[model samples]
Target: MRNTPDQEKELDESPLTDGSDELYERLSLKVDKGQEPLRIDKFLVQRIENASRNKIQKALEAGMVLVNNKQVQPNYKIRPLDEIVMYSDKEAHGEEIIPEELPLNIEYEDDDVMIINKPPGLVVHPASGNYSGTLINGVAWYLLQKNKELSEQDLPRWGLVHRIDKNTSGLMVLAKTEKAVRSLAKQFFDHTVKRQYMALVWGDLVEDSGTIVAHVGRHQRFRKLFDAYPEGDHGKEAITHYKVLERFGYVTLVQCVLETGRTHQIRVHMQHIGHPLFNDDTYGGDKIVKGTVFSKYRQFVDNCFAVCPRHALHAKTIGFVHPATGKDMLFESELPADMREVIAKWRNYIANRLA
Candidate 1:
């Protein structure tokens, strides 16, 4: 939500020339001890007449507001004797579009970067069908009201470094400045950024630990999916290292590390090894496993099989050097409820069958 260069330039050229067009009312307030911080928009709403949250947010993003001479985020806490300035422009009012407040799970943050625990089913950015309520939009509103400043080209992103699949839940990092963005992007491209994942796959793996080295490319038959082979023109080298954590009667829990990132690298590689992730229909597991004994125990198996909504994969760990300070940083996310439920069901099935 910071003022981009374009917005700042526009503000400087206009400079609240007419008092009639200026809607902001300047005020100073004392922050009481033990008072919880209020959102800038909420505070402004209470103080200003007929000012919508969206208007306050846009005004803040246009650099029309200052907190003690420093532009702070919309959600910034107010201390005692804090000076607040609001710059109002009628031109900006027409363009002030209010975005929805989507749910976000922010794990860690500082001036330079922020780390978020992105849950499954949430798109990272807005697309054609999904125009509102994406992570980027939320971050935009979050930053704008915080009174941060950014350049026009970087306005869409407040230092976003990389992305994960919409269906994949895990920890992701965002940059707060252009410098950090470039630094982190270079780290990812140079293969210095480490990422690890946890998955539950069908069948017991033969090896306790091993690596998968193959060339991966889009499937010839299915454009949506990727396939692996020994040779191909479009193929890119992909490597995955996996360690078996536990074994159910038919399924196994695994931890995988990526040496080279490709589209669906883990899922494709696991499927290539005859261990397609449980409930993964994209790589072919739509129907329940069938057999003579399976027919007899179909009901029991179906209950366990229904646990996973999609592929049972979770990004568990990430490591990288700090883009700004050059310090090493690592983050980890525990298994989500859905994945845990899948494991629990598998355990029950195994115990009952073995017993």
Candidate 2:
């Protein structure tokens, strides 16, 4: 189990620095029937790759560890089929950051901009509850190591152009200087930056292509979630264009192009269209919103969830004009192993089911 960013609430903000990145980790595990009673801390150590026994104990102390939806002690024994969830917020609200040497997947970099392949579990910047071990902290460390002349005081202006959702793996370009930052931010603001995402949504879209124009704002009831106003009565103007790429009977893979990058735009827009991205828990895609009720089908869907535990979305492609060189640059990433494997599983399941 790789360390994962289980949830990112990027409402009314950039993907990377949504005003102090929030760490919202959501995890679920099903204990097998044959398992004997074991301490909850011991049980979790095996399922969560990065979770240490110490971490589990800490969670137990903080009331973050729950068994069968109820908070439990560290000594709580795991009964068969116990549902467990570990939710905690390590909020860091300091202006200063302590740099940690985190691994970075650098795709391309130059004097002006750096294109990075952000992993699924990394927050882009420091904020309340997540001041350390963020992408920014790592970048600061990397820069300080590379250039002996610069001080840590220069760390705040890393020239972040835009942000991708924490769990959304994809390409992101960061500005290395103030000039680059201004230029890239202008490009994003003008909607000239070409960006495309691959998403697996719950239901097969009725149209092969369409545009979603709505006023997206905070949900009146669920403040944690966003709602789209199609009537123009409220919210901010947002537009998303989508094209169906492949249909897997129950869920359809689609390419979403952003005309405007509002907070949670893709997730909210797709949900507004009745085709929420698969496994997006914040938007109600975690449950079996599609497919049949048979136990076999249920098992198949559950396997898919386990296969790609995060949202079925990737920042696949991004294009922009170079801020320094005045050249056009485009970067694309192949589907990650998890997304590819699950899509293949669904493809095979559909083929055999239809056959």
Candidate 3:
């Protein structure tokens, strides 16, 4: 779980700070003496227990496999004494998702998959403090109601392919069958899946379109929050491309496209550049990062915070190839009501200020 916000909380069960689905692993191995040249995927498959060749190859396609610190294809041959580094992303689960009768905003569903429009303040899955009333619990109950009853072993993590933070409302795809889970996992692993989010940051961007490339990892001091390393030395690689959509002087609305899913990629990247998401308490967006220190202005900002008491981020669109049909699937979601109301307030306030 991540520190999104209260009321309009941002919560995701992903291992990455971005709240995107996937737990990344870094592995390094030296080729032994008299080692025969083998394809990198095959090499990883043989060396890493419980990892399949298909999964390893998927990691390669996603540019997670590297030779001498450079991305390599699955077919790349491993040479002796060559330093090999690999990054692999996979789903993490603790136990079965217990079925609970809770409200779920299911967008689309079929035999193979289900598309969900997750609402803010909803935990995606059960964790230590939140063992019930999660999206996974609701999903489990929904699936059981529609499909045949099955043993606990039949399901894994409620077939979730990835996650968004709890306070960040957005679209998520869930697999229905074992094959769907494996196929969807491959898509995410390969970085072929497309994810876009809409966010309101506390400052105006200098450029209408720009990219934020940084290394994001857990904060050394505040373990709950993430810190961005713009130098790109430590932490996972994260790239976020943004285009300004609307600007409200003190805040700007932008659309963010993710090339790599790292924990808190958007929030941390924005904050690193000095524009944290509005009302993102964990990242200090809750304070007056932008605008004047005047009492009147401060009061206005406080009013805005009360209107939308959470980080201003929404997963607006997600696109991927269907696991079973091999067809392109894209889903879009409208901004939630709370976000809409807050943006409206900003618009009105700006207009009045100009007048």
Candidate 4:
């Protein structure tokens, strides 16, 4: 159970009048001798309505619970005649939380596997920055709504086989059952899943096509970034095959195929080369250059950065074998509006400049 700060203050003020007055609420419970000594948090979870185990643990860690007028450890045992006091300052409000019925863009669905076209900015799971309204939550709600017509177990359950970054929009596959999950996970372990990406970088590539073979690890100075080291102590072998698609003055469009999937592989590899993705905040592509009268292309470059917030990259395609049916499946997503707009504007700028 949880109460807002304002609600708690109002409840406390309404019950008290004099400045020296004390307000207290007592709760009495009989301890069962047969039951083993349980942790304070575990015990509180059973007593508190609408309170989760995590919430109870936080309360215990914050010293909000007391046993027999004395603060006790989480593992302390409760004896007969022991009084438990929880100073919540106000009564907890209980509200039923129902999952929101949200629409899902499912590309393919089968007994064993499911493919989804994940949009940019939709987080795959719940994390620090995002709590509710996630792709996982939406999937669960979708399954629940489907279960009304079919059996509860018949609905397609998304056991995450692999994950894509929040900002990287593309095809993602999920498993429906435990057997399918194991089979698909084994395929990923065996390097059978083929992944590809398309990126627009800031500079032209000297070579039309090339392979970036490097040992990728966390950067020593900047923990957030990855670096390629010659010595290769703690990094993993990463291979990226890139081919030139089109050229626009100093900028180039390229398609990247991955032999191994690492965190931020495309972004890091692009930065390792002379050409980094435009508007990439992490690997030094943040400045917006407005084209002057002499350099008429500067405004187009600035507008490209203004339209796209993050790196100019997208997970274009993914192909893998279906775990349940042992059939081949391939999925793809087109460039999002932001990336498409950036490319269209850049193409127009280059055409005008050459003309």
Candidate 5:
């Protein structure tokens, strides 16, 4: 319920700043000194009062269960003196939202839903170390300006149906009413919502179109970052279909369609195939991953990075059924200036190289 376009039951609910997912500790316990070796899921069910096995399994699969500060599978055997921690994605409700007079690019709004073209570097919701200056605070202010009464209890997650990463620029839909919340949530949960993203990757894609099937989960070493488990041995299933839109010699522009909207799905999937997003520092695309080894080439890439400081990704298109009208609604946005400028530089660089 925290944030996502999919119905994934895990602690990684929403995309946060730096593409990290915020997790809240729900339970912590240490195994007995002489405890028998049992599956962690079973151990939790037996020890935790009023907790069901199903819930424990869900947490384990979601990487919410950590043993000795490490993520483990549900079948992991509990050892003596094992420190276990469980986390939940549920946000603390009733937190007072401070309304801010931030500018909002409201594309479409009505009694049911409000479509916003969120700019880059704007956080969708407030999290730790970011109590204000977020899109949700602006939304609160906008609603209050219209003289609409807001109750945190009634409007969960600040009426945010889903979210993209803070550094990723894109279109987002917010629920304006309780009915819209339930309806849009159902659409996302059912995976009926359509989302497309534009990304500039480091390498030239050989295939015109392809599908990437992997399990996306938090990286074992870098807990804040995510990785793709191509073997499907870890994490939840994620699928991304990408088509090559344009090809520069060193980089390529691609359009990604999400089949399952896991956190950092497109980023992880593209990185898994050795084509990390251009300038995406978290996924290891900040440095030059392609191009010649000449210093001039290095300087060129550095200039491009300066032009587009963040990851070169944009939520260019989103389509979903109108909650109240019961009609299909589609919205599209052009690439931001930074991304456009960077692409233009690449075009010039490639043309000169060919000449």
Candidate 6:
């Protein structure tokens, strides 16, 4: 997502002058099973550090509090296992980025944007203990190498329009110019970008093609993890349309097209539907959620896990309008060697069973 001369001209007259920044606020809490009933606002005020009852009430009035993915009133009673989420529009802060020289898998680049095919385990940007060796750091160095006197603050997000998880390999676009950033960010916000992911989830999906509609937000208890609220009582709306591609009795390969870009949308939605991505340790796919308990079967699954060693998900296809060219752009990547090898192993295992 980059800007061009034409894009610069278009930006001056674009109608998207207002509300270009992504709106986000988050505070999720999973009620303890042993907790007794209490007013939700009171409960949140007690738990949320520096939270005031008046502010909590205001947030509730603003429809910013959710219980189990559905908006709730301040008087709502908190129940055990109830997932609560509260959010604001204030932007979260991040560490000042530093440039690194890590290698990047560049797929396409232009004056306004760069499309990268990120490998698994490589974080997209810096955070916490990971202030260096991130994709943005490398991108900074790349720009520096090109004699673009860029600084850590030159691009707050280092031109990243969007990002994938640390362990999820995929295609991502980075805007190289402010105009491109605004244009691309608007597209993402408007849900005009086409993004598809390939995932190997546990079990055979009942339907060939369907959409998973849920509200996705942080897990009530596991602050680091996310959960899907099918009851539509808790989080922001998230939609994932999936079509079955291939099936191996115990596992299935599917194409998931995202209608909404929530954190871990595919992973959370798939898991909510009872098919966590294979080898996804975070969402409980690392364990055997399906299949037989036989020793040989266990060994076979173990081998497959070793082959991939991470969640069996890949961002395979991405389509978007170029910021500079104002033309539709589509990019696709083949399944990684690890995923391919594991799929082959499953094929052979099934075949040998028949033989």
Best by lDDT: 5
| lDDT tens digits, residue span 91-209, model 1 | 32222223456677888888778888888777776655676667877777776667656433344343455666677788888878645654565455456678899998878888999
Q: List runs of model 4 lying over 4 Å from the truth.
A: 1-100, 148-158, 288-296
As for candidate 5, its clashing pairs are none
Candidate 6 Cα outliers beyond 4 Å, as residue runs: 1-94, 155-158
Give the residue spans of candidate 5 off by over 4 A: 1-90, 148-156
Query: Every model's Cα RMSD, please?
Result: 16.6, 19.8, 9.2, 16.0, 10.9, 14.5
Candidate 6 Cα deviation (angstroms), residue 344: 1.1
In candidate 2 the C-alpha lDDT for residue 268 amounts to: 87
lDDT of 3 by residue, 69-151 (tens): 67788888888777766654444456657888998898898989999999889988888778889998888787777766666
Each prediction's TM-score against the native? 0.68, 0.73, 0.78, 0.67, 0.75, 0.74
Q: Please, what are the lDDT tens digits per residue for candidate 2 over residues 1-355? A: 3323431121112222222121233455666677799998887787665567887797677565667868788889999877776653333234786767889899998888888898777777776777788888888888888897887877643355567778898888888875566566656756788989999999988999999999777788877677888997766678889999999989999999988777788898899988888999999889898888899999999999999999999989999999878899999999888899999999999999899
Best by TM-score: 3
TM-score, candidate 1, is: 0.68
Name the candidate, 1 or 6, with the larger lDDT value: 6
The C-alpha stretches of model 1 lying farther than 4 A from their native spots are 1-99, 148-158, 289-296
Candidate 6 lDDT tens digits, 216-308: 877888877888899977667788999999988899999999877888889999999999999999999998889888898899899999999
The TM-score, computed over Cα atoms with residue i paired to residue i, of candidate 6 is: 0.74
Instruction: Tell me model 1's lDDT, rounded to 2 decimals.
Output: 0.68
Worst 10 residues of 3 by lDDT: 3-12
C-alpha lDDT of all candidate models, in order:
0.68, 0.77, 0.79, 0.65, 0.80, 0.79
Q: For residues 1-355, write the lDDT of model 5, one tens digit per residue.
A: 1222231222232333233222222456766688789999888777665668887897677566779978799999999988876654344444667788899999898888889999999998887778799999888888777866755443335367678889999899887764565566556655678999999999989899999998888888888788899898767778899999999978999999987777888989999999999999999999989877789889999999999999999999999999788999999998999999999999998898799
Model 2 weakest 10-residue run by lDDT: 7-16
